[model samples]
Target: MLHQSRQSITCELDAGNSNCLTITACYAANLNTERSDLWVDLINVQQQLSLDSSPWVVGGDFNQISHFSEHSLPSVNCYDSPMSEFRDTLSHLGIFDLRFTRPLHTWSNKCPSSRIAKKLDRILVNQPWVSSFPHSQATFLPPDISDHAPAILNLAVNLPTSGTKPFKFFNYLTKHPLFYQTVLQAWHQSGSIAWDLSHLCVKLKKIKSDIKKLNRENFSDIQERVRVANRLLNDAQVLALTHPTQENFLKEKELHDKWEFLRTIEESYFRQRSRINWLREGDHNTTFFHRLMQVRNSYNSIRSFTLSTGEVVTDPVVMGVIAISHFQQLLAPQTTLTSPCSLAWFQALSPFRCPESNAQAMILLPSDEEIERMLFKLNANKTSGPDSLTSELLKAAWNFLGAEALPWEYRSKDIWIQLKQVSEHTGSLL
Candidate 1:
């Protein structure tokens, strides 16, 4: 134990593998006047010991709720003074509520007639603590006998490894300085084939390989890069301080700039993967994004499925087979149509017949400008097709692709059919 008081006790935790953490178990006073002192005391501990950027946790009954929704009782005033004070204290200490599971309300008044429930007990930590234990969760057990529920913190370090996943195009890659040049170079290097559609597919496939290489070389280990940059910056600062030379100061500045750049890139990378559109960039929301990504992966995972024979199957291989069989059956051709539609049937529908001029226009080959407009209309952030080509990549290399020559026999009708097939399925041409 590091510090002890009537309201709180602080301790240093050593969880093996050189991972040390400082924890504080606190119980604030019921009265606002006395509870104010507890807040000050906790802040004093934090400031005096310089624990701002360290792995630290403070958990216990705060004797108050931070948000209005936390309490069952509604009030005319949405912002309560006591709640505001508690929130401010936490904000000042760089502490935020840890992600939790199980019971939402931790404390109840236990009154059957007019019961009051509030989330007064919470585990809070700083950014450092979250980074150290990214998958940690606090589970609040049911308050059986006592009014306050017991909270258990689990540091889930082990994560299940997944197999090779399909290629996905991230929007942030477009923001890279070398993106446009690298893609254009690869596009030209692929050259053109006899068929226009085949030529486009070949170019796209080539660029996809180049893009993968670019990511592997520069962007794959972003978090590790951030750590290395930070370490280098710290070392340079120390050197400048000890030697006080011009060269040392210049080196420190360069390293500081490099660290900031890498940090920004890392933030953008996770932000795209998180798929959160509301939150804007530059908010230092990387920790939230990282946790959210994990949550999404867990939610989307298929652990088990029930078969048609009233049996539950958890084996992955069996599940894959089941999925394949289901899709194959669904997509199999149907011969049950009593009367298949023919050209005469379409001509009989005079009310829905196309106009003569419109029919002629439709048959005419699509111009480069028309095709470019359609390509630009595609959603850049959407997942890549089976060809591993994204809308963003197509748009970026349009200058080269739009000028490519096509055989004179190719008609607009054939191109339109192919385009429709690409849109509906794998975005690949036959």
Candidate 2:
């Protein structure tokens, strides 16, 4: 039965025995709704699917691309918010995308003028059902009647595996009551801090190397190796927790935690490195910003640092400014003084004298040659010639003194004043 907005038709397959399979064909319209409505719809679908006793398979055109990478059109605008929310919904309901292994462009128009393709259709199945149907595969059929291409998926019933192995808890057994206490005793015996850190680093490195060797040999899966390492780490953590005062145990525990954090960082670096290479080749600054936000959000799990005002500023721009300012401070010159001689000091050493109105004696100013040398030194520091800066400073001095002396009065004073004002106004001041 077909319905609007949210509709799913459930069908039961008659497989001889009491065992049966239920299939749901669902279709959701492309329309924006309030978050609550979306949540309600997702919950309704999930509850309906949960009623099935047999293997459940949901297949239909979801009208959504699971990721931004699925779209390749230059002009097509892709948004991550809705897609991210949808993925979260699927994950919350224990559903895995069955179409992840194939290319994103499933439907393409063969028309000469308008050519468009998109992977709006998808198939989601439970892991147990997927494992049971090993030979089943989903394929996009050729377009014939409509713009969308129908997807065909082959299905199989339950199958048995080779053997049932015992549940392995990795290295959990190594931290048994007897072995853990022995390791703790040995750790307590190691007294030196530096030696303890070095030893812990060596042990962690050896464990990681062993895991890598096993992975390279294709002997075990990553989950197994991680489980084993995690057990060992948990044992170390327990010992540390038991002996809070033991410095060596605490150091070893910290080292183990750091190794895990480093591994996470390495994984994230590789993930972003691939995305950055793709972004460099394409004009997708918007996508780059979106990915940057995701990475920044991931940093929230790390240690938190607060500002002086007790506000936490995690924005990239603020972080970048802090980093740049720190670098500049580190590289700044040792002294703030611009020149060896102050303006007052130079004035005091002058030979020329200015007649004072209040004082009985005349105040001595610098001679033309000595003033020229001082001006040269000042202008040298500012990359402006002595003639220009000295001329401007003198004009300013004359203005401050309220002197309107004519050009010929002080050997072309008018021309000098005009040039000086022009230079100062034009920012040519030393």
C-alpha lDDT of all candidate models, in order? 0.75, 0.47
lDDT digits (tens) for residues 214-260 of candidate 2: 32453244335445667777777777788766785867677686546
TM-score leader: 1
User: lDDT by residue for model 1 over 1-430, one digit each (tens)?
Assistant: 8888879999999977888999999998999999999999999989876778788999999998898888787762387899899999998998887777566789988898988899989999877786677767676887888999999988762333345776766655766789888877877787754354544555666667778877777777899999999999999999999999999999999999888877777877677666776787778788788866655553355555667675767566777788888887888645575867898878887868668999999767766566667778875545556665566665665565545533443344466665554443336221
* Pairs of residues clashing in candidate 1: none
lDDT, candidate 2, residue 55? 60
| TM-score list, all predictions | 0.58, 0.34
Per-residue error for 374 in candidate 2, Å, reads 63
Instruction: Count backbone overlaps in model 2.
Output: 3
Candidate 2 lowest-lDDT run of ten = 166-175
Q: Tell me the lDDT of model 1 at 60.
A: 99
